[model samples]
Target: MADKHNDISSTELRANTPEQAVLSTPTDDIHVANGAADKSKNQKIRKATNIILIVVAFLFVFHLIADRYIPSTDLGRVRGFVVPITPQVSGEVIEILTTPNTLIRKGQVLARINPRDYEIALFTAEQNVTQAGQNMGALTANVTAAKAKVVNAEANFTNAKVQSKRIFTMVEQQVMSEADADNARAELASAEAGVASAKADLAKAEERLGSEGENNTAVKSALLALEQAELNLARSEIKAPTDGVASNFRLKEGFYANAGQPVMTFISSEDVWIEANFRENSLGNMQAGDKVEFALDYAPGEVFTGKVAYIDYGVDWGQSEQTGKLAQTTGQTGWLRQSQRFPVTIHFDDEEAKGLRRVGGQADVMVYTEENSLMNLFGKFWIRVVSWFSYVR
Candidate 1:
């Protein structure tokens, strides 16, 4: 019986050992759990690393955009000079020396008027002056001749007096007749009358000369007419006042140009500037002499530098709403007021590249300003108060 029980127990132990071997061998499960844990840790590490990288990239880009390359505001604009040319005299436009978009220099003749009429008028005026001078000269010569005649007459009168004296002495001595004395007296009287007439003629000539020298209305009128003729003559040739490009040149050969008529416009490309119509609110930090940078629509790649030249005296707020302004001018369009805009002029320092810019071209401008510490702090506090009040309301 003991031998039989031992054989059965050995067999059971062998079968149980196989089952235990299957349950106890846990190496594969351990490897799988270890792999899962490693994978989870790796995923968490990758997510954290990605988050860090994203933050770093964002900061770098934000810094670049803020410090180095700030976004431009298209609200800015470009401005330039616009001038009108008008004729001072009335005449036919004989020639047109410029075309549209043509570049020209200062003092360059853009057009000419029909100069024949002006020339003829000038010649007539000159002739009138010459004739007047000749007339004056003739009068002067006449006076000179009259003076000589007066001298001759005086001499004759003296001789007649001497003869009369001799005749009187003879009569007293009973050697000459009283008739001879009477005749000598009559001759002296005639000589004296002749001298008086000559002196009167000389005085008349002197008066004529004096009239021209002092308050001669007729001479003054003539001089004014002559001056007008000369001015008209000068107006025949249209010359530019400064070096610039001529535009709106509409006059052609043989076209009549009237007085005070618009001939053409001269745009000075040499003096370039940007007139920014900034809002009144935007002007709080803006001032003259502030640094500015600009970009032009025509030349997008170029960065033009400038400074604030001046700010407007007052804001134009009327029609400000329609015009999108922060302030309004008193006499502006509307009465039920809205926002208004003030104009600020900025002068460009670069002269070399000014020629490339055109009037009315759009430009973006930026005014460099330092933040005000007190103002900023006050503004933040005010904003928070306003927000709280809005919520309460």
Candidate 2:
């Protein structure tokens, strides 16, 4: 009976298959559900895209305003005068008076070389100077005696002129013979010859002693050598040039310090400044003397005050130094170029920043170029926020 009913149902379904079917199969229901699901998915995608666009736009607008009014940069460094301490005179380091990371004052003795050798050099120089002076003084006395002889000769010549004139007058008046006049003329000529001879002797003496005269080149050279020796002896004891912290010390007792070679690095605390790289667009109103706020990575939750000491006119990007040859410019790979950064030097207004500053340390800086209350307030708050963020940095 079931088989007969199934056969009858199949025949009825086939007969009503054209367009008059009252019941639907499960395949058609599945197609309709898939269509609804696809439409819902597309709607969700569009909504998400709109939300993302809105967020991006908001961020762009916020950045533009913040950067324009309050120019701030995280690419900042705590900078100061980093002096390389080099010994002016070379010697074996006998004593290291300065410890690493300690504050050093200007002119403080940092290290001492084996000063015994320098002391010997100084003594030798002094002795040589004294000997040269004594030798040159004897030669100088000869020249002085020669000059006196010349003066005496000139005086005798003058006296001979007067005597010759008197003798000529006596001969002319017939009171003396022509022989007396001739003898007077002969004496005058002899006196003139004596003067010439004395001058020649003086010249010869000067020429002989000039090589090592009292104030001659040799004496001057000896004096200069003596001065140089003294300077070298003083330099054996190395002194600090500026107040700073001695760091990265590479010297110890028994070490040999070469002349003009750096032994340690001195990070000068004097004139501490921040070198902040800022985008060109943000520097529209930025210039020297502008008020600035900054923070350091070492001191989190603390902001420092400063001013724009100066702004770099340009950067050295893609630039080669003068080498007497044309620079072969290299082509960039990208279709667009990135914004260039200029260094803005900020000087500390408060002494606290100078005390806490370090060379090449990380910093965040904000320059207040304009008088916008909103921007200034935001900049102050932003710097503090950055300061707190340094805890993680």
Candidate 3:
């Protein structure tokens, strides 16, 4: 019975010993468990890193595809012929007919120079022409008078020659004295000199007369001066060149305007376009006549349609009228280079856009060079996004 009791105690001790070992565990086993937990944490970190890399790669590829298929740019401007309103002739501003920022029709008078000076010039030119005509008439009369004088002098010369010949014959026949014949000869010589003088006066008169009627050189020159005076007087009105709006109108009633100097800003509304700057790499499929869409900064949440007019071929970064200078060195010399941008002209499909044109206005543009539905849809969404973002901007 004691041996049996001993065996039962040993069995219970063995079972309790296994439970104690499980509760207390060795340092080596604890280290192993800690290492396993560390491994599991490392695996979780690696999985998160891989997911992030995949997302980044996908976004990079998507950007490449979108950029290639449907190129978009926020660097766009509403471009038109913004001309400087310069006076053809110089004068003091006497009156302004046009109001500020008003629509002016073609050939509408914008302002007027002091016409008193031009009026005086026109009057002087008219007087010069009158004087020229009067002079021409006097010259014609002088030619007629000179011709009559020449004929009279020739008749006298003929009469003197006949009388001298008769007197010489009479002297030779002993009917007249030598003194009388000498007197007749002297008269003949005098008559001949008078005829020569009269002919010279007639020639002088004819030469001064020039061509007949309006063909006269002096008359034509006077007429030309008169025409120029009229032109200058008309130019003093300062009419608008085309149908458009005016700006920067600092011209006043007393301002002195110089010839060929800009006094006001006039933009032509006949031709309007969007000058969009697009990245060079994204312009692979871009060509003229491609469809386009854009949004103006002023008109937020509005999408306007257009067509690609043309793509610029060159950039004049270093070109200038000034010369004899070395080229400027590039600021960056790293392996990565900044992308080059080229201008792409776009024409609005909306006819109302022309009437509502504003030069130098900011815009966001997108060019669809191909019929890529997915990419184009993305582009449309992108531009509308920009249009909505314009409100925040």
Candidate 4:
């Protein structure tokens, strides 16, 4: 009985011990080796992540510094269009040739005025010119006739003088009658009077001819009349001055309009540009002739190019004179004031602009005054240098 109990206990102990021991052998060894390798790998990964984060932080800080030192402005409100139109004559609207928002070419007829009155006035003026010319011609002919009369009068006076002298000699010798001599003397005096009359008539004719000659008052009146006629004729035709889209048509077809009244206005679509108003403080690095890059709210995915063409000389709120003193609130610390804004006009160099489009569309203009990093840094440095130099000098 004792031997049997001991054998069963030993068998149970061996069974439990062999299975447990065999199962734990490879697991324990593998667990120890894996733990060591994982610790090493985790340390390496953390170190690498920390190093990458540090580099990224440094780069971010550098970028912040660069942005603060460099001056930048968002000028998005500057835009304008060219207005080119003028009325040369005044008349009543008789015909309408264009509608609102219609595209018109250069020299296209825009409207017509009532031409009947103008045409009649032109005809009357032409008649006046023709009459003046005829009067001048008639005066010139009279001058020639008066000159001939003067020559005939002179010859008659000479012949009468000779005959009178002969008659006086005969009377002095008592071979001729006194009445005859007296009559001859009277004839000679009458002939001399005729010459004076003819001379006076010739002078009058010459004066009349001169009055109607070129550059004379009568001729000037005629020319003025002709010009007025031509102007009236021209007033009948209303034409566009340039290629543009018509707008603001206050007069319509068959509408009666007076002189100096505007019939319509047009906007050219080809000359569009952006006008950016940047703060005065942001102008330190800005200048004319700088290239610009810009975008528009209307057209997306399209990049536009332009050049800075002008900058305003001064800044003003453009308040009316009746308004009181102007002031603005800027968030800043005491003892310093914020800079004001001024306007700058940028011209687009794109083919779309050169094609005669109406400018004045709203756009944002960012001028690239400094293309390189070094240039941007040096520009700021130069401003500070000039500031210091001003104090020293």
User: Highest lDDT, which number?
Assistant: 3
Better of 2 and 4 by lDDT: 2
TM-score of each: 0.62, 0.73, 0.75, 0.68
> Sort by lDDT, best first: what order?
3, 2, 4, 1
Q: What do the candidate models score in CA lDDT, each in turn?
A: 0.70, 0.86, 0.88, 0.71
RMSD, one per candidate, in order: 12.8, 7.4, 6.0, 11.7
Comparing 1 with 2 on lDDT, the higher-scoring candidate is 2
What 10-residue stretch in candidate 4 is worst by lDDT? Answer: 384-393
Q: Give the per-residue lDDT digits (tens) of candidate 2, residues 1-393.
A: 999999778757755664534445557769999999999999999999999999999989988887877889999998888789899888899999999988888889999998898889889988988878887788778888999999999999999999999999999999999999999999999999999999999998787578654467667777888998899999999888888889898787999999989999887877688899999889987878888888999888998888998999988887775788877776666855787899988888868665678788999998888876677987888788889998877
Off by over 4 Å in 4: 1-74, 77-92, 211-216, 269-273, 317-336, 353-360, 371-393
As for model 2, its CA RMSD to the true structure in angstroms is 7.4
Residue 292 displacement in candidate 2 (angstroms): 1.3
Which of the predicted structures, 2 or 4, would earn the higher TM-score when compared with the native? Answer: 2
Better of 1 and 4 by lDDT: 4
**Model 4: per-residue Cα lDDT at residue 4:** 100
The TM-score-based order of candidates, best leading, equals 3, 2, 4, 1
Q: What is candidate 3's lDDT per residue for 43-108, written digit by digit as tens?
A: 999999999999999999999888888889999999888888888888999899987778889999
TM-score of 1: 0.62
